[model samples]
Target: MSNKATHASGASSDGAELRRRNVPGESNGSAVPTQAEVDNKKSHKPKSQSSILSTLDEYEFLIAPLIFTFLAFFTRMYKIGLSDIVTWDEAHFGKFGSHYIKREFYFDVHPPLGKMLVGLSGVLAGYNGSFEFKSGEKYPEELNYTFMRLFNSAFGAVCVPLAYYTARELNFRRPAVWLVTLMVLFENSYATISRFILLDSMLLCFTFTTVLCWARFHRLRHESFSVEWFTWLFLTGISIGCVCSVKWVGMFGTALVGFYTIEDLWNKFGDLKMPKVELASHVSARVVGLIIIPVLVYMFTFWVHFLVLENSGPGDAQMSSLFQANLRGTEVGKDSPLEIAYGSRATLKNMGYGGGLLHSHVQTYPEGSQQQQVTCYHHKDANNDWFFYPNRNKPLYNPEEPIEYVGDKDIIRLIHSQTGRNLHSHTVSAPVTKADYEVSSYGNTTVGDEKDHWTVEVVNDAASNDWTKIRTLTTSFRLKHTSLGCYLRAGNVNLPQWGFKQIEVTCVKENKPRDVYTHWNVESHWNERLPASDPGSYKSPFLRDFVHLNVAMMTSNNALVPDPDKQDDLASHFWQWPILNVGLRMCGWDDHIVKYFLLGNPIVYWGSTASLAGFFVLIGWYLVRWQRGYQELKPIEIDQIHYGGIYPVVGWFLHYLPFVAMARVTYVHHYYPALYFAILTMGFMLDWVTRPLARTHKTIEWAIYGVLYVVVISLFILFRAIVFGMEGDNKQWRHLRWFEKWRITD
Candidate 1:
């Protein structure tokens, strides 16, 4: 007998009632029962096998998933503040919080909600000044770090629970919900990112929560299109908008929620063949819930800082009202040359750089000239060309010139010493004497022939094998000529193996054979001057000890400006190096922060790509196996629910396209959109995979299921290779294939 006929006859009657009650038990009767009888039987059922397992069938499919979600929450909140250092971006948030609580909203790169939340925490901690939370100070240091990290950790912790609810709402089995929650919890990316002091984790939390709410609404109230569904839809919109305010990447969540709402509306009306009154109400409710509510929520989150703060600055107001401002008027004021030019100013308002335009200008220089001019401000000379002047002559410094002393003497000394060493002493010219030589003794005098006026004697010291020369001479010369010049003269000199040593010289009147005067003994030589003190070596007393102490105190106390240097570093660092700097700033120093929010431990920034590929491969494998199972069941003629319907195909295609596009993008932030799409697609795919199992299966069906599994595995490997190879040197494009080239281009 056919499976459907069997279900209709004999024990199948009770089995149908069991299916209606969604209870697992043996049937004892052979006749079909009334709805009231089935309800009565359900009420009389015993629940002793397992409380938890029984609760799963009694309450809803979501209970087990919710329990699994607690694992993620615990991991995110565990030991969040191991690192005591106040990172660059954390300092910025700390400052924003301080200012915010003081009724002052400062303009920043992002909207106000994140800063407000952080500030609210600081206010709770009784933050006072920049130096209140320093280490070893009056305030508790542990509390300081924990306070700053609390919101991010809490938000991140909730994502696991949100994922569970999302999966359960899609009719996922307990195992699937547990798998997804565990993946979210243990996945290095999700775990690490929860500890950050940045917006990405918060954005993820808000986005995921919004998705969960939408899914719940879909499963429970979507069929009836109730007022409660509209309320949940509004809440979802608010969450999505709040996420977008934190980071623009959260817009992907907004889009997903919007798509789901529209789909919900269409499904409600289309099922009844678009009846006018029913369709109008459905369309109107979706318009209010999805479009109008989300826009309002987005604006509300963006403007809350402005409303709450008393003295919001012009910059703050501009940033908070960015979407409301007139772009063309803002553009006109920014075109002045007096303002600094850097780049296109279109994104500047949204990015919080008002009253400025960024532009690049070319510069040019003439041949053989050391001077250059900015081409925008100065016209180039007629002779200037963009060609290299290989043969152009430039003035060279003469070593003999006095002013040339400023040139590098070290290089000249090296060359000259090497040349002297290479040449023979006999080939060297003898010293020229233009004046008479003189000798003086403290108690006696000695005279020598004019040709032998100078006598040279060489002495060798045991410590050094080098010879030292003593020259005795009668000399007369003016003191001014040689005494104050670059070179010094001396008498009774001692030479070391390295070079010249302590020497002294006496000044005399020209042509006189006697000493006129001396400036004491002149015992020390000018070349042997002691090293001068370098002013640069000196550091401030504040910086050497007190400043860092102050910063520590401030951070610990949850005070404003915990570290001013760190705050400045975030702004300037991001402006200087946008890509790497922004990523690092957002990730923070906490390993958990990068792990949870970025989707993998950013320690291996590329791991997300691999995980993404693996996830898709699993989905593809499951699909192939499901198809194979269907083929095998065909022979048995067992009537089963065919799950791969028009809706599933549409959902999968819509969802997968975004992820495929994301994998090919250059920027990592683009992955958020891909993640949003992939998740929804997986949900739809799961729905398709499970629907067929609702019916009775024969042995042939089970065999087909096994064969399908093998087929899926093979197809996954093949598809993965094609997708991964298309990325080539770009690991980010691992989801794109040659056949899917449009994803890369898009």
Candidate 2:
């Protein structure tokens, strides 16, 4: 119970469980499990602590992770409260934290879990959330953000030990654990991120814990229902939820868990002791524990989020009128009764697959389908509003006599109220979408013709007509272009500034009803007859609010095309991450005289990169030898060393490779997850490579490792000023800026 895996049953308790599973010397009336097989199962129980201490290996258990954690925290804490200035993304997240402290509802592209922690940290430290965390704005002297940095630094400290335990769990030797701990402690980019009020460090920390927990579970799965097995599995799920709550990038951790689960089940299925029917139980448990539990936790976090931020803030314009009504301070409409009518002026959002507001603007796409641009705008605007008509020949609605309900499948024409152009489509190809018919606002005359007519279809036939009726609060509707022989779709492609950067509206080639975004609810309705006091009628439920938040975040993320004019020199290319070629510009540019950079320590970085490559070669050689029967892999050694190397490599790629394909801007810190993976990989490989050398000449391996730590420590000392904030003349910065891309200013 002394170590972290006490729940998994300690080495002392493992004797009984090990005998139960293996039945030593009592084979199933046949060949007994070889010594190798017993070692494979028993290795999960770490050697007794007293035994390790007697031999001096206790330093690895007691000192390595702790020393590294202290080292990392000590390094990170140097300038924690020294300066109070807004830098890079701190302005965005810090401001979000402020809004949270103020109990104001706002929107973010990411889930609120990270911001909640940030705000909570500030609250704990006596921050009142009063400062405007604007770009280039210095923090007021009154706000002490030290606790915020310290909050994340605490997570970073745990990560140092997390790397150690995770590597050791893989059956890696003590040297591997040391390397992983040191790698995490000495990484410069990590050091800097830990010092800031950022979510990346927290994300990294949680992700590491998630993987570590899963690793322990994997090592102890045979002992089902044991406290350790249950605890690790439960912790794995909890850590997964925590990481994802911080950022969607945490989904990658879930992906890794999913893969591990499959591998687990697959191996169990082949076991003679496991009946095929038992596979169902395995799957069912995972579905509940891994899938259901994490989902519930993730959703619950949002529940807390929506509860706290009840007041309205800047994001009100990005949501439906009904959803906005729930936010305190929002000017919501009052209760009023109205009926569906042809002349009713209502804003129609795309009720197809893409959930964009049915919109039209004065500008036209320059290329093919050059009609007045009809697009799906995410924002609520006058341009998104439309007026329904029954072709030009039909007389204007006789409002005095009666109001006609425009029920499902009713033929209608939608005229863009702002542009005075009909929502028209033809056989011509859409501007950006291939093979899809073009859809645009086109009506040269004041009225629309056959080309403009569209058949109206209600999205949910089962839902109450009372809710779907025109002028009703957030009624869902769809439009089918009568002339184009196709349905309307809110295309995901974004238009240029000429079209106000909204999503394009395309005539779909098929009439697929499954597209969720195409399902639109009228956000704002205008009918003088329907009195302006119907706010309660438009109250959006929690699910609808969740959907609106997602739609808004997706659109915001998509619209993030890089603006060259706004692009900073600090933006790093995807390749620069591994080689430590560039780093973030923490404080600079005619703002703060002190400059800080988050570059990796070059020796650890380049060494890890080389180690990763060498590891691949080592694996290839081992496989070739095994195939030729020239070598027999020691099963016990394989678990701790070669196979152990795989988890981190997978993690590294899971985090790193996806960025290579990402179109959005990337920077060096994005590589830290992969960097952590590489460190673990190096740890496993070095332990394996040097074990023989250490046996023949014990001092050589320790000497090499000692040399490595010395180099790392020396580099950290040299780069400390740049890693932390340091003010100096240009001459001093030139020496610190080792790479040309690292723009450390005076």
Candidate 3:
């Protein structure tokens, strides 16, 4: 009954035949059958194949999934582009797509795949990138954003068929497959969300397809390198790249595939009869398909990203001077510091949480410290400029001189270049993180007292490199206050608008010496009398820029605080997502008729949730009984129930659980990936329950199928206005609010 043996024996027709062809249960892929069972099956075979019930089964199996898939497409596409006004995220993402069309540079937090496709769809549809894409901006009669929405809708439409196929591959019977497909198709929230210019629908499509591809791969495992096997594997890799390109959320798909690959390989390794080289071959092939190919495709999206975006936009402020110089429309200064030296004007960047430039401003923290605020800003600014000076006041000294370089343990003071204030710290508590000391530009004079003296420690040093010597963009350093022993901290916390919304900087000592928050780097160097190179020559290496961009993005994501104006005001927690605790208003909340709200069909949503619980209860009962020796199971049973059913559960958790941990605001749309798995689990449970009964009354299976389908269709009929748009004040909206959390009433 072990899954290892099930995988070994159940995948082959020859292995099943070795047991017996004498009973229907023999080939069920779970257990062997007795002689009586075989005789019973033989008696029923003719009636099951030719009787009225059998005929009904065939029509349902062959026609229902397809019909539901078509319905899913139509329901999603009917007047899909009805709303031309920019919805919540449309202004930003739509504008990003326009930037791509104009070949203009901009920065976004996600991987390039989703936005790149959006931009490509716009270009193909003849959008000229002239729309300003301002939030709440009404679409002009001449401007068409329909094609981009249509592209996402088309992909979103694929989820229904993919669900059907994936369930079918998992051995769910016709009734179960139909239920699964319809559950996805009739979901109200998916219907409304997919029709908008957003990435969620497209991401769900790719995520669902990736799971389906893996199911196909599992089914073809016996074929080795056969066309079906290779094709499924290739498709899985491509979808991983696609999903990952869309958002980092796709990493869960990559993880699901990765974990399954390892398990599959473990099973392969246990096959003693298989040649040893077969394991090597399997690993090598998967490495190519899963790792190398996906990575190349991921990089290719960036290649296209860099290719299309040449002109600089608002994003230039976040990048290094060297990176900005490569962008069009930016003035590149044609000078470099002779060499980093004492009295050199330098921008010291905090290589801490999120990596920001050490910045100061006239604004004060206002509350706790109340001194002039010192913080780390992600963008380039003159406020970030500072002059490096010796801690002990001597007439100016050259710590940057090669012969007399600043080395490790050197005491130094940094003077704010703009305000001529010395960088100083005090015993006052920081405004946000009270335990940490408040760091600010306190003294007016360039000469520093004890509080202004900081010891510079070279981070990446050997016998050859010194701490006192400064290099731009090459070396990293840590500044420790010589008096209090606290290290400079860029905790990646945000300050209020008074501080220009930069990262909060404090002074705190840590138990460990390698705390990343204490590190710093020189971002820009300015000195006269040294040879000047082309502004472009000092640019960080191309590879470094790519790494830097990703690092900056990760840092930004980690520090993302919700903006009331941008994120949905009705953002739901992960717990609320599954039950439809709250619905996001798409647009038009006033008394006007014909409004859109993103809410899922409760029948499908709740059914999926119940199915998730049912899977555990149903599967756990059989598994526990078998494990406890109270019952016996056949290889086919193990294959059908455990091996087949456990995956979607794993996938459901993989997709759903992370949302609970995310710091970013989440909406109901986030549950769609988990919903796919829930639907599959529901289908499998229905199939497992009704399979044996099909030979007898056919009543249990058909009755449940009829009721679920009828309910879903009725819900769809009642909620037609949710997607197509209807008057918000209508009684229909009030009726749709099953719970106060639904917020269906405009």
TM-score for each predicted model, relative to the true structure = 0.46, 0.86, 0.83
* Local lDDT at 604 for model 3: 81
Return the lDDT, model 3, position 740: 74
Flag the better candidate by lDDT, 1 or 2.
2
Worst 10 residues of 1 by lDDT: 414-423
Give the worst 10-residue stretch by lDDT in candidate 2. 21-30
| Tens digit per residue, CA lDDT, model 1, 581-681 | 23212323222321111223221222223333444575566568778773433411221111212222233344334444442212344333244334434
Of 1 and 3, which scores higher on lDDT?
3
- Strongest candidate by lDDT: 3
* Model 2, span 1-746: residue lDDT tens: 22222322323334322222111111111234478975774576566744564345324465556677777778878777766677778888998888889888777878778889988888987899888887667777677778788886788777888887787666554555666777778777788888888888888899899979887787776577677777888888888888888887788778888888888788888888877677777788788789888887788788888888888777665666566667787643333333456766776655432356688778787877677888886566788778766665566556675666676777877778887788898888876676788888887436556888887667662225453355444456667777766788775677666766667777786776767555555555666655564544445667766766766676666555567648556677878877778777776545436566778888778888888788789889988998888755554445544346776778777888778777777667778777877887777777677666544666777788788878877887788776677765645657877767777643
lDDT of 2: 0.71
C-alpha positional error of residue 462 in candidate 2 after TM-score superposition, expressed in Å: 8.6
lDDT of 2 at 201: 86
Candidate 2 vs candidate 3, TM-score winner: 2
- Backbone atom clashes (below 3 Å) for every candidate: 38, 22, 17
